[model samples]
Target: MIEILNPTLLARARETGALVADILDTLRSRCAAGTNLLDIDRWAKALIVEAGAVSCYVDYAPSFGRGPFGHYICTGVNDAVLHGRPYDYTLADGDLLTLDLAVSKDGVAADAAISFLVGDARDAESVALIETTERALAAGIAAARPGARVGDISHAIGTVLGEAGYAINTDFGGHGIGSTMHQDPHVPNAGRPGRGYTLRPGLLLALEPWVMADTAQLVTDADGWTLRSATGCRTAHSEHTIAITDDGAEILTLPRRAREL
Candidate 1:
């Protein structure tokens, strides 16, 4: 459903967005080599409870996924990209990790994702992939404004990824978010400009730009949740929840520390 939130609801949205961003920042700082993915999930759960928020992942059963995500966060490492269910794996130095999180506070939902490398093991290719996704995310956010079509955002994201020489995957992408986690208006990583749903004030969109190093194809892991690159290439993802306003797009999911700066 396309929801144009009311003023009070929008305020609640801000709160939810802040929580999501704060939790992601904390997790990023805490994750390192020797850290178990399951520990990260547990840490996320504690943070969510401490904030009095609800997890959009646990008990989430969708047709595409094995019912009931049963976790607090998605942990995508190296080849894993989307819907990566937390497991027993411990992060290694230089491992590329992507953490995707969504939560609801005061009845409003916010979603965001970040990709980064672990420890001091920084592979140039991994760094490039992460940087590319971040740049693509910025481009997509720049294209989001009142009256702009969703295609415009898609095109902006596509242009960045395309120029970086990464193949685009359309199987899963960004979506609308409000009282619920995933909503209407699927924003692909690539699309034709001047087409698709037109943006409007008060509209909230979670625009994510993700890419695999070599191919656009994906393969589901035996765990029934992790989505990995079909060619076993490294991947990266970046995302944020944005609200269309009169001036432009306000990125609600930007970290509070960043906002303070």
Candidate 2:
């Protein structure tokens, strides 16, 4: 369903977006060498509950995933990319970790993700991969404006990834998000411009551009939720919830503070 937020709803969306961004910033800072994935999930849960918000993931049973995600956030480490279910994994130095989070506050939901390297070790390749996704995300957002089609955003995102030499996967991409977590208008990482859903004021979209280092194929882990690269190649993902405005797009999930390195 495509939900056009009224003034009141828009305010709630902003609040939810800020909350998601803050939580991600906190989690990214806390993650480091020897950090446990479960601990991060716990921290997210505490913060969400404390803020009187709800988790869009918990108890969510989609056809593609195992029932009841049962986790507060998604932790994609190294090869893992999307729908990464938190497990007993402990982060290692130089490990590329991606955290994707969505929360509902005041009945509005906002989603966002960030990819970062853990600990003191910053591998050049890993840094490049992370930066590429971030740049692609920015390009996608820049293309989102009133009267623009979803394809415009997709094309902008794909250009950045393709130029960076990363393999793109369309099996899963961005989508409309609002009162619900996943809604209509599937925004692919790559596509032709001037096609698909047309942008309108009040529309909210989550544009995510993710890529694997050397493969477009994905393999589901035994857990049935974590999506990993077919060749075990390192991957990166970046995302944010944006609102279509009369003049342009407003990024609702942007971080308010710089996360500690």
Candidate 3:
């Protein structure tokens, strides 16, 4: 369902967005060499509960997934990308980690993801992968404004990823988000400009740009949730929840004191 937030609901959306961003930022800071994935999940749960918010993923059970997702957050590492279920694993230096989080506060939901290297070891390939996704996410947000079509945002994102020599995957991309975790107006990572649903004020969209190093194909891990690159190469994902406005898009999910998008 597509939801256009009213003024009051929009306010709640901003709050939820800030909360989600803050939680992701906190998780990022806590993650490092020797960190356990389950510990990350526990920390996320505590933060969400302490804020009096609800985790959108904890009970999510879609047709594509095995069952209700029991984790508080998605913890993807290295080859793992989307829907990564937290497991027993200790992170090491230079491991690329992706944390995708969605939560609701005051009945409004916001979603975002960030991919970064754990610890001080920043390998060239891993850094490039994370930076590319961040650039693509920024480009996508830039294209989102009143009267612009969803395809415009998709095209902008695709241009950045494609130019960086990464293949685009449309199987899973961004989507409308508000009142709930996911909604209508599916936003692909790549598409023609001027196609799909037109943007309007009050519309909230989660634009995520993710890519695998070598292949566009994905393979589901035995856990039936974590999606990994077919080539087992490194991957990266970046996302933000933005609201279409009269003049432009407002990135609600920017973390506190975060660099400008």
Candidate 4:
């Protein structure tokens, strides 16, 4: 559904977004070589509960995924990209990790994701993958405003990934988010400009830009959830929830510390 959040609901949304961002930031700081993916999940649960918020994923049951995600956060390691169900795996130095989180507080929801390397390991390719996604996310956000169309944001994001020589995957992308984690007006990573739904004040959208190093194809893991690159190439994803306003798009999911600064 396309929801134009009212001021009261929007205020609640800001609270939820800050909580999601803070939790993600805390979890990122805890990840390192020897860290367990399951531990990350536990940390997410603790943070969400402590904030009096609930996960949008744990009980998320969609036709594409195994019913009831049963995990507080998605842990995508190296080849894993989307819907990566947390498992018993130890992160190694230089492992590329992607943490995707969504939560609801006071009946409002926010979603965001971040990709980073573990410990002191940083390969050129891995660094490129992560940087490209972040740039694409910024480009997408820059294209978002009261008068622009969703396609404008998609085109902006796709331009960055395309120029970076990464293959774009359309199977899953960003979408409208508001009281719920996922909503209508599907925002693909790549699309033609001047198309799709026109933006308006009070609209909330989660703009995500993700890419695989070599191919656009994806293979699901045996767990029936985690999506990995078909060529075993490293991947990266970046996302944020933004609210349309009179001036422009206001990023709702930036870390509380970042917002303060």
- Number of clashes found in candidate 4: 0
Kindly report which residue stretches of model 3 are placed more than 4 angstroms away from their true locations once superposed. 259-261
Q: Write the per-residue lDDT of candidate 3 for residues 97-157, one digit (tens) a residue.
A: 9999999998999999999999888788888999999999999999999999999999999
Model 4 over residues 120-211: C-alpha lDDT tens digits? 96689999999999999999999999989999999999999999998788879999999889999999999999999999999999999999
Per-model lDDT: 0.94, 0.93, 0.94, 0.94
Q: 2 or 4: which has the higher TM-score?
A: 4
Clashing pairs in 4: none
Give per-model CA RMSD.
0.6, 1.8, 1.3, 0.6
Clashes of each: 0, 0, 0, 0
TM-score of each: 0.99, 0.97, 0.98, 0.99
lDDT of 2 by residue, 1-261 (tens): 888888889888988998999999888888889999999999999999999999999988999997789999999999999999999999999999999999998889999999998988988888899999999999999999999999999999999999999878888999999989999999999999999999999999999999898999999999989999999989999999999999899999977773233
RMSD of 2: 1.8
User: Between 2 and 4, whose lDDT is larger?
Assistant: 4
Clash list (residue pairs), candidate 1: none
TM-score of 3: 0.98
